[model samples]
Target: MNGKFIAIEGLEGAGKTNAIKQVGKILQEQGVHKIVFTREPGGTPLAEALRTLVKYGIDDEVITHEAELLMLYAARVQVLENVIKPAVTQGAWVVTDRYDLSSQAYQGGGRGIDSGLLNTLRDTILGNFYPDLTLYMDVAPSIGLKRVRSRTSGELDRIEVEPLAFFERIRSRYQILAEKDDRIITLDASQELSEVTSALRVQLIKWLKNKGY
Candidate 1:
């Protein structure tokens, strides 16, 4: 693709929404006008339906780890083929709220799924497709959950309702993956909102400069 692809990743309540807005502002300042924003598991009609199923599940029916992971990939492939690919092919920068890495951390680490199985699924389903850059907002599980609780009083989704230990594991996995990958930037999201945004702006700008944006 001629255009760039950026993916934002984080645990729940890591201020990704604000980070995305900051990214947009920075890109605009850098004279990037053709920007397309998307979210994983819900970027298209079919994908949205699958997102709902994966998030809420059927009434009183248990969703196995494997089933959940498969549902995510189904939704993901739909977004990839229908929305992201077309946008990027047309030279529009594609910014996504989440992507394949979410599954690696949440399913592989939190759900205790096998890494080999996860890697195989990713390789088979997505092949070499991946974000040009990934911004991982790092936050402590307790603090992140506190933010979530403060922001919304409604019922939590399936993944959001996961225990603290689960999130801790996911965070650990994210750190591990980010450390190993040059494309992924681990941002400290435990700071205040303003501080987090400031840090994000600096990192994004640095990356943009490196890419000759």
Candidate 2:
């Protein structure tokens, strides 16, 4: 049987780490042994470099939104071709922390980039490529940012330091996109960790069974 590509997406502090762990556990329980884990913009060596640039940026240099978006796609393409595609083709489930949806939410909505341009870029770059299942952990920007700030002692990354309005826009786009896509499942991430985990497990199991996993 062929493998599947699963992606988890949300704003920072949406508990993506927990969601990823839960997905792995559920997949194992469902008898999926060959799983390839990945995190967007850092799955490969080249992509890792780009991830650093995107996250921290260069010394004393202003990074434009257009450049940021391009760099993200560059990193995404590298991982998609080098890691994700090969793993799934070889019958290993590919689980990624983020995917194209991040671009749509962060770059398109948060940065207020033109939707036509974003759509054109996505279609031109990726064609029909997309995750088989996308799990979106939805949380309010204020709540999510508070959770993020509480955990990290170090300074926030470039994107992480964006205003609450930025994250709010991203969250809005995420909800809009998730609602439109059948393959994307939205989980309320404002709940306690245990509750989120329970919800994730239930949803994942149902999806897995539906897919005949």
Candidate 3:
């Protein structure tokens, strides 16, 4: 694809929605007006259905770990094929809230699934496709959950109600992945909103310039 693809990744309550806004603002200021905003598991109609099933299964219908993992990728490829690939192919920047990294953290780390198997599934579905840049918003689970509680008024989705240990593992995996990938940068989401935005803006501007955008 000719256009850049940037993925914003983090655990729940990491302010990814706001981060996407900052990304849009940064690109707009750089004279890049054609941009598409998307999130994993819900960017298209079918994907949205999968998203609902993943987040909230119908009345006690158990969502097994295997099913959750598969559904996530299923929705992901749908969005990638119908939305992300086309947007980037048409020279429009794509800004996504989450992608494969999430599955790695949530399923592989948090749920104790093996990374090797997840890798196989990822390769089978996505092949060599990946975002050019991924910004991981790092925050302590306790602090993040507090923010989440305030925002959601203590109401949480199924996954959001997972134990604190789940998020800890997810964050640990995120840190490891960020350390290994040059294209992924870890941002401290615990900072004030303005500071977080400034840091994100600077990182994106530098990366975009490096890419000759």
- Models 1 onward score TM values of 0.98, 0.98, 0.97
State the lDDT of candidate 2 residue by residue for 12-80, as single tens digits.
999999999989989999899899999987899999999999999999899999999999999998999
**Pairs of residues at least 3 apart in sequence or in different chains that clash in candidate 1:** none
Q: Write the per-residue lDDT of candidate 1 for residues 136-165, one digit (tens) a residue.
A: 999999999999988887888988888899
For model 2 the local lDDT of residue 105 reads: 97
Superposition error at 83 for model 1 (Å) = 0.7
The model with the greater lDDT, 2 or 3, is: 2
The lDDT for every candidate, in the order shown, is: 0.93, 0.94, 0.92
Most TM-score-accurate candidate: 2
lDDT minimum window of 10 residues, candidate 1: 151-160
> Which ranking of candidates, highest lDDT first?
2, 1, 3
Scored against the true structure, residue 92 in model 3 reaches a CA lDDT of 97
Please identify which of the two predictions, 1 or 3, would achieve the higher lDDT against the true structure: 1
The positional error of residue 132 in candidate 3, measured at the CA in angstroms, is 0.4
Off-target runs (Cα >4 Å) in candidate 1 are none
